[model samples]
Target: GMAEEEARMMRIDPEKLTQIILMGYTTKEARRGLRSAQGNIDQAVEFIIENRRLREECHREEEAREEEERIQRRYGLTENGQKINITYLQQLQSMGYPRRACVEALKQSNNRLEEASEMLLTNLDTLITASRVAKRDNEDDDDQETELMEDATHIPQLIALGAEFEEARALLEIYGNRLERAVEELLQKAQDSYETMHEHNDPSLFERARTAVEKRMAKKIRLAEQSAADQQRRT
Candidate 1:
């Protein structure tokens, strides 16, 4: 509506009256300023306020961006710097230090990688020393218990009564050899039993009776050996 009125005024005999209203000045003020300035409403308005404001805003934004760039440069917190720091942290983690510990070590070392690694190694050494001390203390406790038990029991009496050292050593050696042989025989027997069990789901009654007879014969042989040994020891 204002623009239409201005256009109507411009279409009238004088175009100056249209410029005064659009330039936000009264007709008398427009006339006074018209001698020094042209009656150009657009240029006047731009010069008076709009252009300055736009230029100031643009300058402020540019300064703000420059200040941000300056801060990032000063602190070395740019993209490349972040990448380098991340790589450093990863290297610390790969070297067996926990991430949080690595970060703290880095800070304590003034962000020096070598110093941080040395600190971490020192911490590990401390932990290892503590663990060894604990293990030694545990071993000492066990030794004390064993000594106490030995002092409380009658070990000498047990050794004297039917406990021949040479015979016991010889028997243990023989038993060890026998155990190896027995294991091999048991493995073979187990394999054979598995095969036999799988091969024949049902067998004749005579076959079952024959297996029972063989088991009884082996048991009688063991009993005879044991009886002969007992009789020899008594004599």
Candidate 2:
């Protein structure tokens, strides 16, 4: 009688409550469902049925999307509007073309595997030469002289200040390793960049144009004077 009364409070028949419990629901869980349904057995059953149906639908949708992705990958159809054949990729790789380079060529050749391969082969020499040139450029970047200049206290200090070692060495060379002049040159460059970024025009466009011309003339005069002084010093 007590069990039946408890089931009545849940608004379900005792047999239905027993069946729900036997279907792996705890009594506490069944009680929660009754509360959610406002003690309506029919509503609670309907809610549980809808929930299960929605969950299954979501699961099926997710499985379908995953299967589509798997099929796409197997056929080498990229999601990025490019259709690359896996067999073509393997054939290119076998012929020593880099995978990334092959992909690029394939895209450029409109995904025609034979055309992509031919393009790569036809320009192989030019490509190799270009690649070598790029590599040499990188090596040149790395080969900045690390050796300390004869009069410099630190080579890395100049490098840290964004001066290539050779550039710093040349500055030091020209100034006979005077740290002050080298540092001044670097600071001047920074100042020039700051002035360029912050430079404001006069309210009058004529005034702005005049100021620019004057600055250019003054720069030329200064350069001529410096050149003369350098030549006299050399003599």
Candidate 3:
């Protein structure tokens, strides 16, 4: 083992090692780099830099892998030890589903794209709404990812008017980014969503007439309030 020990000792230049240390390389690293470069100081310095770069690159890649694993766990992908296929995710995104809904649907449908598509198409409204709630309770990355996936400018504008992020983003898309029109659409969706459930098709004709009239009046009042609010905002 004398040869092995001698090889380990090699010909590390103390001055080069010290210089490398002064440049913030650890003494152990400096010694390794200097020996590897055969005591050429410039080569040693380059070796140290390259070594550190490689290490940093490796560390970054490891962190990315861990983050991906964490996402899979958070969205239930880890439950079955299955990774969401990137191709399917991209396909779903191309189909206009936000990444959050696509991810959840993929998990629920066992990674079957067809079932996920159907689930998303049928329950999109509920999923989009749930996605908002989930995002609000999630981390900064969720906010950043949602911002990237949705219309960045209009969601916040509509949020200031009390719309949820998903709802606001979806409406803005439908109205071709017309902010006021989007707001009106949002107000319309919310205004009678609750009252419509109670509308009776077989009520006494008189009772149906009176309730319908009341709903019309109530809708007009809300619309007026929205218009005044919009006008005030503009001024």
Candidate 4:
């Protein structure tokens, strides 16, 4: 009785059975096929071939849809290639390309993105060279100005004040315009008779002054060292 009931249930639904048969198999053929296989799916594969075909067709359509969407999102067709907007221009400016140079490079390269990037890099090189040249010119101008100022000033004051050649040159270069500060500093040095400003005209006097300064510095160094030693011992 169970086998008979199973056999009756195994009878295919007429609507589904019609669709399958319309695709090519007859109803008797579909039922015979299912019954011969005893409802085993692996054995009834050819009977469900239409379903498998429909599934594969739907999968292909979905893949095509996804590919088109991806293309639109990645490279939306705009009027003038991919939009090189203001943000990109600002980014180029921050990388050190002058505003005029950036615009010129973009125009020269026919607004091609990669070519424009290369042009900006080339302009940066030119700017660096120009900066170096300007720095050198400025330094030369400063040296010339210092020499002119030194020639115009009294050399005897520098020699008498025991100012080193370099210090005198610097003062002449910068302080020639600030006469009050220069005079005040000179007067202070003269009053203090600081060892740095004391000239040693004779070899003996030079040696004597050198020895005195050295001894004074040595005395200070010894006092500092003794204080450090006392602190260390206490610790």
Ranking by lDDT: 3, 2, 4, 1
Off by over 4 Å in 2: 1-19, 22-32, 78-235
Alpha-carbon TM-score of each model against the true structure: 0.22, 0.26, 0.47, 0.19
**How much is the lDDT of residue 16 in candidate 3?**
68
After superposition on all C-alphas, the RMSD of every candidate to the true structure, in Å, is: 29.1, 21.8, 18.8, 27.0
Question: What digit string (tens of lDDT, one per residue) describes model 1 on residues 101-189?
Answer: 44445545556788767876666444334333544554433222111111111222222333333332333344453434434444565
Q: Residue-pair clashes per candidate, as listed?
A: 0, 0, 0, 0
- Best model per TM-score: 3
Q: Cα deviation in Å at residue 67, candidate 3?
A: 1.2
Show the lowest summed lDDT stretch of 10 residues, model 4.
Answer: 143-152
lDDT of 3 by residue, 72-133 (tens): 65655622568876568778766556778777677777789998888877776565666667
Q: Per-residue lDDT tens digits of candidate 4, residues 94-204?
A: 443433344434444545656766765545445334434544654533222222321223332453466654555455556763545655676776656654455444445
lDDT of 2: 0.62
Winner of 1 and 3 under TM-score: 3
lDDT by residue for model 2 over 1-235, one digit each (tens)? 9998666675745666666667676676566666567666667666666767897999999997775455334334333577665567667645545444455456556678788778666654443344345435544333232333243333335666877656766777777778789888978877677767766742355577889999999999999999999999999
RMSD of 4: 27.0
